[model samples]
Target: MTLVSGPTGGGSIDDFELFYARRALGRLRSRLGRQGLLDLLAEDIGKGEAFLRESAGLSGGSFNVGATVLATRGSTAGEFVAWMDKAFADENVLLAAQPEHYVMAGQPDGAVHIVENIGPHVCSFYLGSWSAEALAWAADAEELLPEAEFPHKKASNLFLADGTVVGRVLIQFGDTDDGFTSSLTVYLPTACPESVLEHHLRHFAVEFRNWIVASTTARA
Candidate 1:
């Protein structure tokens, strides 16, 4: 599958589904911390990539893989939810025309939302360290599960969200890498029209980028 980055300057993951499959690692971090993020990555980044690919309904081949976890320097745990809440959906954040398609879910305790965007869902999460016990449950196939028809090496894949694009993203992969592969996808329930999906996606991407740039500057 071709890989792409959301817009570098501005835009949502409008037609993002075309070239990018996305996931949020920060949810795990909310419960597990920075180490939690690392543990999951170490155990099964490949699995996650495969899951995204299948779910996004993209053609399969090779994909570029990269991730960005932004944090607000010096914010207490209590401040996290509010900060991310706005990031997910606020005047400056959420940018969808049909409001129903891009719903924002606030964080609950340390657990973040997984998403239910059948019609409209925008999952909110925070990024940090990794969790050690993040063993490869997501990556592991059950003993009773069916096996693949033909086995092939795992390959690198890029993760993206609404508004992000695959234009330059695929051009960045190096070589000789593999991790996981699975086809966990979503069916439309609250599925919005393509144009609405694009708008919400772009909103999600633009909001995320603004937060990242601001947070980075604060840290610097």
Candidate 2:
């Protein structure tokens, strides 16, 4: 990731992601406790998400891992539908639209399981605090924006149960304060195109699972 200045004086997503990843990895390795690792990863993911969101000119919403987890504590699969229904029952617009500025202002895009370990056990992931306005507007206008123009589409700030993974590339469309932003997050599992659920499971699940296992083993 080369650190190049965009038309603006700010650094590009590539620069930020690289810097963020290095810092995050360092912090992850430095921590000797599971809680410390989770905190560091959450903070790093928030910073990375903010960088990409701001660099791409989207309104960078607040980044929160705990908030996301708490929001979905009892949520079931596809529960976003129910959540959105209750959230927007009075509003005419969808939650995806005006995401940052809407009622569910601080809520993330959605929650997905990073991995299902040992059958019922699962590691959940949350990525919010980035804007999706550009994708939402683009869809309505039938216009397409380049990946560089929209960071959310090019990259995602991943938060696992235990470590963090950045850049999960996916062509996602949704509405936000800016309109409809179309872009991908940076750290995805692989180059293969998969659903959000599958992407998390493949890329972040194992890493987090291993971390948890190691932490438990060390404590024991």
Candidate 3:
């Protein structure tokens, strides 16, 4: 795969998924405090398919990956949820949350049009919101279990421009004593390099952190 330079003013990970992911994890650990980070891991452990195992399950030219971030400290779940409501309704905010080479636009019918430039080829998908059951599943406290009053969750299934189902994404948030945590999962059929998945993970880290900070700041 051809590795293109990412956006200016951003550290681009062209082919260093492991290195970048480790660094991102360390940074998150430092920022969230070791105990706070441990809280995240405690929740993540033994949950559903292991990350690499899930990645290996990809077949027929498709793959999936996810990233989790301790988005904010000292904010209520309701506050974060309200912020997300406004943020998702704003196209600009949604666009700002994406990494380089990924563009998202909202449709009139509440679907999202996504264009991804994955180096070797461009892929387009229309993402429609998940049903209530799916949303609850995505917001489950455990990876593969459902939880009540999960605080917030937004999810969608990806479809080709022609309407063939291709993949899905889930963004879920939960409340903690420290604040809110976010888990972002992306599944796609692009069959891109593993580095691409890592890049998106880092993308989730940076963008969600900023948005969480913004949310708290606004409340303050």
Indicate which candidate wins on lDDT. Answer: 3
Query: In terms of TM-score, how similar is model 3 to the real structure?
Result: 0.59
* lDDT of prediction 3: 0.57
Listed per model in order, the count of residue pairs whose N, CA or C atoms clash below 3 Å is 38, 29, 0
Q: Estimate every model's Cα lDDT from 0 to 1.
A: 0.30, 0.33, 0.57
* lDDT (Cα, 0-100) at 27 in candidate 2: 49
Q: What residue runs in model 3 are displaced by over 4 Å at the alpha carbon?
A: 1-63, 98-103, 116-122, 133-142, 145-151
Q: Candidate 2: deviation at residue 8, Å?
A: 62
RMSD of each: 17.8, 20.1, 14.5
Candidate 3 lDDT, 1-220, residue by residue in tens:
6457654544435536745754665455447653453354443432311332333345453546555655567897778778876776665566444433234567787777665433233455577854575455344434432345354667766666556655567776777777766767766544446666676666667667767777888778
- Our tally of clashes for model 3 stands at 0
Instruction: Give per-residue CA lDDT, model 1, range 100-188, as digits (tens).
Output: 22222333332222221221333222211112222122144222123242122111122234422111111011112232221211111
Candidate 2: where are CA atoms >4 Å away? Answer: 1-121, 132-144, 147-155, 161-163, 166-187, 191-220
